[model samples]
Target: RTYAGLPVLGGDLIVHESASGASRSVDKATDADIEVTDTSAAIAPSGAERSALSAAQAAGDRKTGAEDAPRKVIWAATGKPVLAYETVVTGVRKDGTPSKLHVITDADSGRKLYEFQAVQNGTGTGQHNGKVTVGSVRSGSQWLLKDSARGGHRTYNLKHSWDETKKGSAFYDADNVWGNGKPTIAQTAAVDAHYGAAMTWDYYKKVLGRNGIKGNGKAAYSRVHFGDAYENAFWDDDCFCMTYGDGAGNKKPLTSLDVAGHEMSHGLTSATANLEYSGESGGLNEATSDIFGTAVEFYAKNAKDPGDYLIGEKIDINGDGTPLRYMDKPSKDGLSYDYWKSGVGNDDPHFTSGIANHFFYLLSEGS
Candidate 1:
């Protein structure tokens, strides 16, 4: 329930019911005042909207659009109740990235309070393990790329387009098995990605005791072949999905097992710590994903791609036949810092991640 359109916390309430259906309740939780005396706003709705748009613009949002009127509500999340106007702004940046931001402003002062992005922007394998087992759903006479056992995990093929309106079709086959252990066939990459997702789910469930990425027993989906000549994979929070791209010339796909785990771990990080993607915190964020990605690789114990401290060893993103990064001795790559020092936060996350990755490697495997 809410008071003056503000959420009321029930953490302090205790209710007792008798056999006659009479109920008694005691309130002991809230001590802060919830009254709002300044209902008469000094700033108009247009002012609030301007403040929100200005805030979004200051935060690097371009092509900004917002609601004409802000909604009045009580914000009790901070334990201090305050009347505020919540404004939602949607737009894309100069880089072609989309943004859906919610801005909160003081109803009376029109001062911005808080804002957050709605889209979560943040995979892998094969040439990977030889042959792997995957969980799939059998419908009629077809084996769909849906895992019924793990909250119905599904994988779709985007057919090299970035548009979400035209969703890629789900992979289905006559046989229960998938992938040919090669990248020549499109299904081969899908097989590796599907298997990687399953292994990641198992790793979290069996090793960490987490049911799924969100720990809510819900499985996220994956989209393969995201764009043309694309050589990357990413996890999007908005769709709760992981997307993979085909490497140069459309021969290699970035769907290796460790890559899958790495991308999925980003989702886990966002759902949990939400480590800011910049500065020292951003380094920690990238390292967290690398740590878990390595863990998942070892957990799978596939012979073809044995567990190792190197990342993307199988993908060979570099034409020189080298992994994207190294953990055992990060400096081997000639760019990553093997040890922490002052101002490490200034470095790119991929490079700064080396410090934590090295530490985790030493902690888990030891020198």
Candidate 2:
């Protein structure tokens, strides 16, 4: 993945090996190009991000919040790899989804080479699971939102901030009572996030026999109340955590059980297959999360939020009580496709994902 001591993109793969090491095959990131280039920026780095952002905006890519310093990399998406700068910008999208935009600029020519979204916005649940229990630990007198049994997993509060430097504060309670199932209280969202994380964790470990999101027995963190009036939840592999935004006036938190499972499963996909987040592969990436998320919901079997084939039913993201996505018939959203067409990959991954979502429903529950 390196050429002249710089990282090279589009040169990775996912190998599937049987447990006995008898069967093997390449499963992901197979579009590698045999190209190499030296590492040297021909132009000044001051205007790289500005240029990229300008182009992104002109193309209707909006709501950019944080921009990362440009980093030199060997771009292999082209037949010939050349020194390029990759910049990642984080913000909330117009659909209330958290966004991570990657802008690749040719270092020598100062030409924008490529761009893609890294954030995975997904639908999922539970202002709607009734009162639930979350694992907590006490450090002296104050009870923490951390759960040690589950790989010492912890939850934090972003307080509507998207600052990358800050990891956010931990939720502390004197009596360890946590939230009261109300959205106004700050602890309320934290409870949902913490419980959601716990449920997702238990589902993978107990049902799937996986240790954690990364399968290394370590847990990913969660942050709640991210951004002002934010109405979505997202998973950014760069952050190694799941973030939930308060929906519609900072009152409707998107930290449902299924939502947690969906976002966290994104981490799992990134860790394992890491399917490119565009075209048909991108759509499959999202559907994989949806499949596992629904599995987690069923595994929980919580009486308040019973398992169902519906996605985002509890969040009311559409202003009505309609679920964000329908697995049985994706066209119910009026935007998704029930089956593949010639140019389905051209659609947003969220919409194109309906194809796989529908297939999974039929495969799992059957027509």
Model 2 lDDT per residue over 284-360, tens place = 99998888889888988878778888888888888888999999999988999899999999989999989999999
Model 1, CA-based lDDT: 0.79
Stretches of candidate 1 exceeding 4 Å from the true structure:
1-126, 164-166
TM-score of candidate 1 to 2 decimals: 0.65
Q: What is the C-alpha RMSD of each candidate to the true structure, in Å?
A: 19.7, 22.4
Superposed by TM-score, candidate 1 places the C-alpha of residue 350 at a distance from the truth, in angstroms, of 0.6
Could you give candidate 1's per-residue lDDT for residues 1-367 as a string of tens digits?
4665554433234567778878865554556766667556677778888988898898888889884567776654456667777788877655544566888888877878788765422122345766766656566688777765566788898888978544588887786667676767677788788878888998998799998999998999989888887988888889988899888777778888899999999999999999998988988989998899899999988888889999988887886789999999999999998999999999899899999999999998878
What Cα-based lDDT does every candidate model obtain? 0.79, 0.79
lDDT of 2: 0.79
